[model samples]
Target chain A: MSDGLSILLSDVDVGPRRHPFLRVDHLQAAAGECVGIIGPNGAGKTTLLKLCCGLIRPNRGTVLLDDRPVGGWRGWRGWQGRRIGYIPQQTEYNSHLPFSLRDVVAMGRNALKPALRPLDGADFEAVDHWIAEMGLHDRRHQTFRSLSGGQQQKALIARAMVAAPRLVVLDEPAANLDTRSRWQLRDIMERLFRDRAMTVLLVSHDVEFLPGACERLLLLRRGRIETDGPRDEVLASPSAADVLAEI
Target chain B: MMDAYFIPILIAGAFAGLSIGLLSVFIVGMRMPFIGSCISHAAMVGAVYASLFQVNPTLGALVLSILAAAGVAFIHPHRRHFDANTGQAILLAFMMGLVFLAVALEEGSRTEMLGLLWGSILFADWGTVVVTGGLAVLLVAFVIAFEKELKAVLFSRSLAAVTSAATEPVYLAFLCFCGLILAVNLKAVGGLLIFSLLVCPAAAAYQVCRGYRSVLLAATGFGAMATTLGFLGSYVFNLPTGACTVIVGTLIFGACSLVRRALAISE
Candidate 1:
């Protein structure tokens, strides 16, 4: 755990009923660190990410952002939307809904007050910036459901980023993406990491796509971190490989 | 003469058709037809209670319906296992109260309570036309103004929240509105038949359309058609117009189902 870190998990235990899915004794990602969480399929990486965003609460221990305990604030949803942007592994759109790409991206701004205060020129400029940044400027008006898997993923990322949160968490952002799209996503994420002051916490089973720019690595096995250190050290560890085998 | 009373009755029937028809689309899309039916039946009890107490039946029904709607909405998100059972219990309590009050009232008490128990389009008047018209217009306007928000919430509650939309207040207002409309229209359709009006057309529309906007429009059309056709049938065959209206609605639903199947098989 780095002293300058903005996020910390202290003995966070999440489980189903009597079985603990994952346990985080102590883990931290420094301010503006591009952290990657890699582990076996059932190692609870997703659960850990969810806990950080306050989407799910741990049975014990505390999750802290910038050293402030997440649940310590009573209004967690408001806090989450404002500071943390989360992109889930998979999104299932209700076929009945008709939402455009712009609509989807705009959802990232849910934390903003809705008292007849319309999105003005500055907001439109921000939306356009994200649209072009993700290379979805032309597809902004298309219905989200009509897009391909890779395109949808890009749009989802754009949606999350448009909120301009301090921390962005993405779970397997390249899972179903084509080779070319995956590379493009990696490049986009790298650019965002380098240019924007956005701290990224990415969880991926695919080792090939872990961005070269990642600042730290945490590998989980059976709900506990197997290796936690600088990216190369953790990725090269035997225990981390064992965690990968199970993933 | 048919000219004197028939026109007003026909107009009332049309109003009934439009209000329930439009609302049913929301019910079907949200998968809450049973909830709607339960509210309608509970509202009937409120109407009877109002009539028995010598107060405005509309006011009584509104209060009761709002309370019932709130109870269900609050419990629905928190307690799925007990929601249906609890709703049934509420319906039963209100029904029993209505029946008991009816029995205890004076034999000659001239509130014409039975009229509400089994409503008639034949009883439709200028007042019924006005109230139903106002409600129908409001329902259509609200649905259009908040279409995206409505679809978001109806499709998936968590998904809706994840989106930029502020879904809590909209969801609350939706439940309350459902109860309010059911209470208001109880005077036209009665408690028993209200469920049919609220569900049949929308269910039929779901069979025909994948697009939500189309589904709502189709459901509204189905409802209006049923009311008009039902009124004509009742007039010609001398059957109860309300019952006939429900019968027509069911037939329309059946026809739509058959058409959907035929299209599927051909494709």
Candidate 2:
């Protein structure tokens, strides 16, 4: 509660069809900590991130970000642009949607302003910067459907980061990338995090891809954190063995 | 082959071209072509009641259409609880019931009951033309102004809701707009035949266009084309203009589908 990088979840519950899909009794990710959430498939790792992002409200408890209830934090677009960046798992975007890579990336900026005005000079610069950063300059003008898996994943990351949010929540970003692309992303994330004081909540099953990039870890099992500590400590814990076995 | 009735047919074709084009685009994007059909058919019941009550049949149609649209929205039957199909079914049934009621109320002027079935583009007067034309123009302008916002809804309703877009009100407005258009154009197109104008062009456009904007534009174009060609074909063959227009649209959709398939195979 006293920490500057603050996220507080108290008795949170999320579900589908009134079934207990996820439950978090209490947890906090203080500022400047890249907390890695590792869990089995359907373990509600993504659900937890969704709660923090205010994309889904808890059925029971409160989700507070920076000492304020998540719902009370107005203007999701403004908050996303300035405070939170979300990179969802790669999926087939609607092919019928005509947004170019640049347009998709610009959505990140739009989420910040929620206005109908044109993207200004500064917005263009941010987009260009992130496009280069993600190594997606070549595909910037291409239709989103035309990009390869790795290229699309990079583009998604660039889109998430274009607003330069303080906290970037990446959900299985490396899920669809090749080993080389994954490493490239890791390096890019390292460089980006170094340039600014940022918090990253990365949800992934691939623990190896993250330990070097993340500062801390929260291992989730059946919707509860079984282990949470520094990267090395949690990685070496018995829960890690259990996590690996489950995976 | 140009009869004295050519002027009336021409005017109906023109107005139908614009309004049907706009309607088809909405039908295509919302992926609810059946809803358009259901609404039009249900409007028939409303039109019948209005005729029986000696009131403006179009107004009755509009009210009923809006009610039907709301009913459809409320009874959303998908596991997601938002799909429009079940509501469409309900609407279709309601329209049939209205037709039955209208048949019972036909104590005299049975031809009037038949009027709702086989429409007369030739009987359209200057007032009807003006109203239909204005509605068409208004529909086109509304689509142009709200294209992006509409596209966002088509992309994802949840995303639209999250992004400060009043999606429910927009959706309701669209349905109401559709109702108004249906009511105005009911005389020229006939409720039984309006579904063709609403579905054919948009379905064709969706077969080829990759973007929603282009699909809308193309659907509008195809709608106009179908109406014009159908009118001409109807005149030459001594056929029903409304039904012929729909037939023309279906043919165009078939052609587009063939072209799409050939291109896919070639690729």
Candidate 3:
């Protein structure tokens, strides 16, 4: 309770079967920390991230952000906004609607305002600042769908950052980018980590793609944490070789 | 006598178009054109059945439409396996069966029921104008209120629910609002015309428009124009207003397709 910018999960288990899809006995990410979650496909890496973000609730235990439950079905005016910014992987955003990059990013401010009020000038200012920071000012007027994979990721980053969250959760942010785009994203993450005070939980398959800030790495296997420790120490462990090879 | 019918019908047309046009943007943007057809058909079943029971058809239609709109959500155990369209399809077939059964069971003259089937601009009155107009205003207010929430949820409900508490409520409210609009417009536009109005105008606008606001305005304008054209075509040529409205909407979509092609625009 009253932990500054932290996420804590206790006895979290997902699914109804004897073997839950995801199970976490206890996990906590402290303030200003970058934790990389790496695992093979279907290892429930994404599920764990969802539980942490409060997107999906567990059948067994609790996930708390700071002192409050994640979202917890809190009202729009509650502590939902300005708290956690989540960029989902495989977003269903490939529609024909004409949302410009700026328009898409501005949604990050939704939690800050009530349902009836529109985004004010300061909101747009923040949206613009993040878009510019991502080096996407030229493409701000373009449709988000038209952007390349890398550009979309950058736009998503801008979207998440616009909220000025205390905690940010990104799932496979650089999953399908080109090598150059991947490196650019790594640099961007490094810069963001250096600049912002927010805690970040990143999920990715490639260890090289995990930003320099991921001093901690969580190696998940079969829906559970196989190894959790320092980035190099976890990778150096003998058990990590088999799981990391699956990547 | 002519003035009394003409004024209210015109008002209803405008407001109905405004409301349905705005809602079209939401459904079309989210690739759920089935919602309009499903609700309209569901309303038809309620209207016909209510007429048999000596109840207000609009009230019955509204209730049923909301039920149909929420039909897919009830399959909790199988929600993961059943997408929205699958749920809609199942409910739609059931509603169709009820519509036929209601017609078969009715004994007397089916004047009100028949009016709901093909529409009766002749039956247009002041009550129709008030309901449609109120719905149009509510829809506008809703859009203003939930712009960000809509953007987030429309893109991905799963994604938005992650961070926003308003996601599920906003989405459920949208589905219910759409039902109410369809129910109110059921008598005036009928199922077929209203379905076309829901899909064609917004789909056409997307062909030529490049932004959310522009598409919304364009869809609203096209919808209003289609309704006015329907009125004029019926008045001048003595055609059925509902059929005329459908033709105009279809033509607008066809013409927009051409315009987009002429301008070499991509999806």
CA lDDT of each candidate?
Answer: 0.73, 0.72, 0.80
**Judged by DockQ cut-offs, is candidate 2 incorrect, acceptable, medium or high?**
incorrect
Which 10 successive residues of model 3 chain B have the least lDDT summed? B72-81
Residue-level lDDT tens digits of model 1 in B159-248: 454443355556667778878888877776777787898889988887776556777888888988888899899889998777988999
Query: Model 2 Cα displacement at A200 (Å)?
Result: 4.1
lDDT of 2 by residue, A1-114 (tens): 212236889988877636666888888887766788899987889878877766667778888777666653353323432356677654323434555677667666644553
* TM-scores of chain A in all candidate models: 0.90, 0.89, 0.93
Give native contacts recovered, as a fraction, per prediction: 0.11, 0.08, 0.61
Residue A212 in candidate 2 has what lDDT? 65
Two-way TM-score contest, 2 vs 3, winner:
3
Q: What is the TM-score of chain B alone in each candidate?
A: 0.88, 0.89, 0.93
- Cα RMSDs of all predictions? 6.0, 4.9, 3.0
Candidate 2: tens digits of C-alpha lDDT, residues B138-180? 8877776655455545544433333333344566677778878
- Per-residue lDDT of candidate 3, residues A1-247 (tens digit): 3212777888888876588888899998888888999999989988887777665667878777765676454522446444677877864454346788898888887767767788999999999999999999998999987889999889988877777777888899887889999999999998987677788899998998998788999999989899999999999999899998887
Candidate 1 error regions (>4 Å): A1-17, A20-31, A57-73, A76-84, A89-92, A113-133, A137-141, A176-180, A220-227, B1-156, B163-165, B186-267
Best by lDDT: 3
Question: In model 3, which regions exceed 4 Å deviation?
Answer: A1-4, A71-82, B1-4, B67-81, B235-238
DockQ, all candidates in order: 0.17, 0.19, 0.45
